[model samples]
Target: MDNWNILLESTNDGFTIATVLEVPDCQIRDETKEGAVEKVQQLLQKRLDKAEIIKIPTPIQPSTLENPVMRFAGIFRDDPDFIEIMKEIRAEREQDSDL
Candidate 1:
């Protein structure tokens, strides 16, 4: 059996809603959280009974040598001021967030 996470929520009408995480359509509403979760689980199980996840081999290279960004890959590696620049950037971000 494939393990799936369940999200539970209380409805305004006193019913409990249970949704299978990552699957917006796999949901159910019931009088109790357990009942709602059980219904959603059954629904998900039935839907995925004949379904599966598979990987496909690809010829694409993530960081190809011909890519333009590769030219800047190690340009800052030898910069002595890079550490101070990163520290200044972090301090600026924290200051902005404080506002």
Candidate 2:
């Protein structure tokens, strides 16, 4: 079984809207919060039943500059100007530090 995070919001018109965070397409509305959740679950189940196979990608952790793993996430080996761009950035930083 897959776990899904559901978001609920109450509208000005007195309807509760439920949205599945993992599956943006799954959304439902009801007069009560409980009903909205039940509807969303049914909708999600239908979606699962219709699909032959479902592939869920691993969720990425929130990254910061201090995270070593995330620091290298954007490095691209095939980019020809990558090294030159890094050099230019380094030079600019060095100039800033010198001032």
Candidate 3:
């Protein structure tokens, strides 16, 4: 039995959707997260029983601070006074939210 990675996302409509990363066509949705997962498992088993071919997904590369994209993502923190800046921003947002 091949192990596959499943992605679960919660919807605003109060449903959980499950998708098998390796098999794009294999998706299931249910009211609860567990139900969605159970359905996907059964769906996968059925496909396997039918002799369908499914490829195992390649593992995702680990993100590192050394990567340019990752390094650039934190550009806002390059400011020497980032901690104070964030505190002020949060305080302003909280004040606005309370209005």
Candidate number with the higher lDDT (1 or 3): 3
Off by over 4 Å in 2: 52-99
Clashes of 1: 0
lDDT of 2 by residue, 1-99 (tens): 878999999999999999999888899999999999999999999998887775899867666336677668867766779978888999999999999
Query: What TM-score fits each model?
Result: 0.55, 0.53, 0.51
Q: Report the CA-based lDDT of candidate 2 relative to the real structure.
A: 0.91
lDDT of 1 at 88: 96
Q: Per-residue CA lDDT of candidate 1, range 5-94, in tens?
A: 888999899999998887888889999988898889888988888778789997877666487877789888878799789889999999
| Ranking, lDDT, top scorer first | 2, 3, 1
Instruction: Order the candidate numbers by TM-score, best to worst.
Output: 1, 2, 3
Clashing pairs in 3: none
Query: Which predicted model would earn the best TM-score?
Result: 1
Which one wins on lDDT? Answer: 2
Among all windows of 10 consecutive residues in model 2, the one with the lowest summed lDDT is 59-68
